[model samples]
Target: MGMHKDQRACRRVDCHDRPILSYGHMVRIAHVTDCYLPRTGGIETQVRALARHQAASGHEVSIITATPGVKRSGTEIVDGLAVTRITAKIPGDLPIHPRTRHHVAAALQENPVDVVHVHVGVISPFAWGAIRAAYQLKIPTVVTVHGIWGPLASPGYRLSELIAKWATWGITISAVSQVAAKTIERAVPTLGEVLVLPNGIDVQDWQLPVRQHDSSTLNLVTVMRLAPRKRTLPLLKIVKAAQERAGITMRIHLRLVGDGPERSRAESFVHQHGLKNLVSFTGRLDHAGIREIFAMSDVYVQPSVKESFGIAALEARAAGLPVIARSQTGTTQFIRDHQEGLLAQTDSGMASAIASLAADRALLAQLGEYNRSTAPEQSWPMVLARVDEAYARARHLD
Candidate 1:
């Protein structure tokens, strides 16, 4: 279901009676996740950044993860942040452990914290275990859902509720976006509240050279892992459809950045569609390289309808480029239709949006200029405020 304006407006569920944390009080926070440093995916990166930001603000922060360290399992200082790894020697070093709850409980007992923040994807075993442990210890726990949990995952949550009765445990639940929160609400109706605590970005870092567009060629760029769930092939099809809609006179070049399991298949699709000349696949590029591309690109396109939060799309918008994203995604939190960029409800709609922008340079420039001048709401300061409030709310629950 699409998120209406009212639903999106309720980003933070209000807590009038709850006690707020005293200003200048030092807070000890423990962040639990399945992934961390040496494994830099979206969840891992967000958890790491959030923990570091908390630490920088004079709060004591530490991390407990299932991701292995150099040793099998140990504690180490990672970039000044203490990371406790509770991992076994599993194949591929997969972030999973049968005794995750036990280890997490031990870690929390070893160093008591004001709140335990657990990060989760659709089905994060380790994170769930950590939540269970925190609940058993009566520690104030907050869970941040970091992925799209559709109907397929509903049964698992139902089972979790049945087995653990977690919904009755008074833990504060949150999702990264409004759309995601609504879906999780539909899945687990018994939860007390599902807050919208979005991921944070350093908007200042994207302050690269202002984008100078060459209105001649329609240059589109998207940076994402080419996984099936990411809809890599569908992205290519949309780019092709947009080109066809724009007509042969308009030269369209799509820079497909990042690589994953679908890379080979997506490359095959591009070649089969006779789009080798129009689309170029660049496996992976660092932040600096992406900023350089942002300067040259006219628009950023993300074709994933299930994107919980399009961080790359946010980065592109931060770098002064108008973005094209699905209307149902968390990207909508930043990009409003016809404001920062156009939003599409379907693949054909996305194609139409691209073609419409290609035809109307005035609207395109206006959106781009608006994005370039305005800052996104997901800045560290604002996100930190929301997280602090979440912590306070969790403490109240405890």
Candidate 2:
């Protein structure tokens, strides 16, 4: 009887004309990530945005993520995506990977998805379980490598590479950025099928009314974790140098918006350097708050010695703020030397770039204009379309 109804439904012209079937509903996808909401980072934001967009586009979308300490029992629908958070034993206060085999096995049995997309970063036990479950079920998998793996060189990297090679395909967010892509390819040559999809921002958010600020008082902002890799101390040093080198006596205010293990060190650096008057720390904030900070700032600077995509810089560009970023890593891809924004390779170079932008109002306005024009191309909608296309190719291969 069910078969007869399904056949009749398939034959009905109205049913055949449904948007779901017409616009790629034939593909059911399960997006797997180690961290979801509550745990914030570039990877988490990308996963949430991609999943929300995919679900809204009529694809059968679901997420399998590790539950935070306060576990929510059972599956919950969030923004139309079914999110299943599984509990895991905390080994010495650290949340290990969830024993997801049984839960994933059950989810797969119920839904029988077509493909699984894993957002790779911060290798936890849960990530391992997801990889194992996907492979055991004969489901084709695609892993998105969000960060460079060489420096970490941990057991997690080896395990992640093994799973990525076994998966149907591998993808890197900064594919066009040679540095980021090459790093991954070096680690695992079997990841040759990797495609780059640059992280995007909502262009609409960048269109906010530019806060009127005195050009003489430059408001510079860097939104990143207070870690050694971010090179926040160097940024503070550069700001101090700017005051002396430029002789402008500009009231340069540096707002650092993320906290980490290096928070105390960063704070101490600010005090030791007597930059307490010039720098302020606003603990990590939500996306909206970050955007608001960008909207008010005259300039955005990212000094990370190593960055995969530098999503913060992208967000700043979308907000029409002139950016001064390091030329190292994937940041160089978005910043054109003297064209869209300034790129500095060394501490002096970064300081010089910031000073130059501060001294020239016309140049700052031009860079801001260029950023606004180019930001729309990197919107999440376009990025997700590329992602969906990649999923289609993975499905075909399967």
Candidate 3:
């Protein structure tokens, strides 16, 4: 039939809606992803953190991924969780195991899990296969979509549903943000209303002592992979535009954190624009390194419009830095235009926001004060509570 059963299953579970949390026994969760540690990104990082938090919370958690191991495929205990790598020797080191369904099913059969929590991106064949395998085995499944599906991707998912009906029956679907969930609703309409499972962060880890920066020079920082879709080049352009708008009164120095294939292109843009003095690439840094940078930085800038959940932005906010990011991104969930930092609708608007912050130190200090004082609601405890709810829903569906 229809989604009648699914509707009943989700009748009480609204998106991010808190129900009376029933603290219960340990849940044996199996996180399935196409990628994991050593291969870092949003989904991989979130999955790892979620699994770790669940494990820390007395739940027995495991991970099944197609991302190749250091050598071959097998089970290994990573950070106390059993990680089963179902990998294939493929070119380009793609996280695509052709026999994902078989391996996933075999792993679960050998080691029973309460739920198969599949972390999916736009093109996660291994994750989709895990969903199918879980469905075939009549195991409870929850699919958390980690990316915003555009027009092409939405239709592509619908076509995939037509072929395999993966969005049907026992699957409980979710996304990282309302913006992302809306896209999934349009993409997998048959799944009905998708759930919102926001990403979590340990605030204490990112929380830095609030302090004022030197007014002579503005140290702007952004943490993101230098990818084309991430708009790294445009961020530099925005920095240049803001410098012009800010005039010679205040010097702006930008540090681009993280590295990707677009590093060379971004470097070329920096050189061509004569921004070598103002812009510097730190390559990639760990949490401690980023915190050290934030300790000395003035503002955190984000320019990606396709951001599903601005975890890095949240980290900067937690680090007590005023954030200036795109309005279209999921970062706007916590960051209001004048509240946390400034949200811009266009490139020029972002530049204007940066310039205004440079000119108006009081406003910047106010935003920074608000951010440091009022903590984000998307903390690990709240996120784990949401995870428990979603897992309960999936178990109920079975």
Candidate 4:
């Protein structure tokens, strides 16, 4: 026989040549990821939002993920979508479910989805299995790399880069931002072209927060998982330095609004640096609680060193709050320095920016207003429209 159909399916599609789907046909999409809620992070948030929108648009959508903890397996419905979880073993930061291939095959055999949408990361065993199952079942596949792979330039990550590249071969690949696309293209040159699909938020859900900034206190809020790359400790130090630099004129209260593996270490760093008075960690909050917190905050801070896209920052911007974040991040794509908010290059620069914003409430209000007005374009519908093109490309990637 001529080459098997699975082997022949490795051909790639031209980046811009995918035809847009004419209205009326609803595609059944299976979103396969390594993690999902109640575990919170950028990927989980985006996946949930995408599934919700896709379902609302009259398409059948389901999220397949590994169950957290030592449980064998379970299934639950959240946001009107079915979330299927399989038992897995946790290794280091990533989870490795040895039976992923079998579970995915089983799921495909039963439901037979149209597209297997896999969310890729540095080390995603489950996602890898989903791709394999896609090939086995002859299902079209779309793989989105959500995290930054630029740091993998080091020798240690060379093997991982090759493995991820190999697994993602023959798949329609996408990144969350232009910077992210460039990063992944550099890491995996053979992937041909990577599309930029920006992370989105439900802007209409985030009503502009009524800000009554207390002159006596400057509230700096950061909503992110307390992971190592997030630089939560550095954020605390910056808040302290900004307070010290601003003098007794204004006190800076830093509210950290998430939890992660690095929480204990972050708390230790706070106590060691005598930041007990300035910092408060609010484990994690749901959307309503987070919106309430954002409504009452002055400025939002993003101190992450390895951010692919800043969803939380965008949400804060939508909430009418000026953001002070590190420069050279994907957030800079939407938030221009001095236009929407201030972007800093270093810890010192971030501290300086914080103090400056705190001192000039008028400037803060000006930037916040601009960000809130411009933030609507990053809404879920706009993002999903672009994603539809990617889905079409995945289907036609002969």
Candidates in order, TM-scores: namely 0.91, 0.84, 0.91, 0.85
Worst 10 residues of 1 by lDDT: 10-19
Checking candidate 2 for backbone clashes, the offending pairs are 97-125, 97-126, 175-196
Candidate 4 weakest lDDT stretch, 10 residues: 11-20
Which scores higher on TM-score, 1 or 2? 1
TM-score of 3: 0.91
RMSD of 1: 7.8
lDDT of 3: 0.82
- Candidate 4 runs further than 4 Å off: 1-24, 68-71, 74-78, 88-94, 150-169
lDDT of 4 at 266: 88
- lDDT of prediction 2: 0.70
Give the range of the ten consecutive residues with the poorest summed lDDT in model 3.
Answer: 12-21
Clashing pairs in 4: none
List, residue by residue over 10-81, the lDDT tens digit for candidate 4: 333321233323333567689999888776667887899899988888888888887463334655677888
Question: Higher TM-score: candidate 3 or 4?
Answer: 3
TM-score of candidate 4 relative to the true fold: 0.85
Could you give candidate 2's per-residue lDDT for residues 77-168 as a string of tens digits?
A: 77767887765566643434446777876776566566778766535566657767876766656666676645666864675456455543
Ranking by TM-score: 1, 3, 4, 2
lDDT, each prediction: 0.82, 0.70, 0.82, 0.77
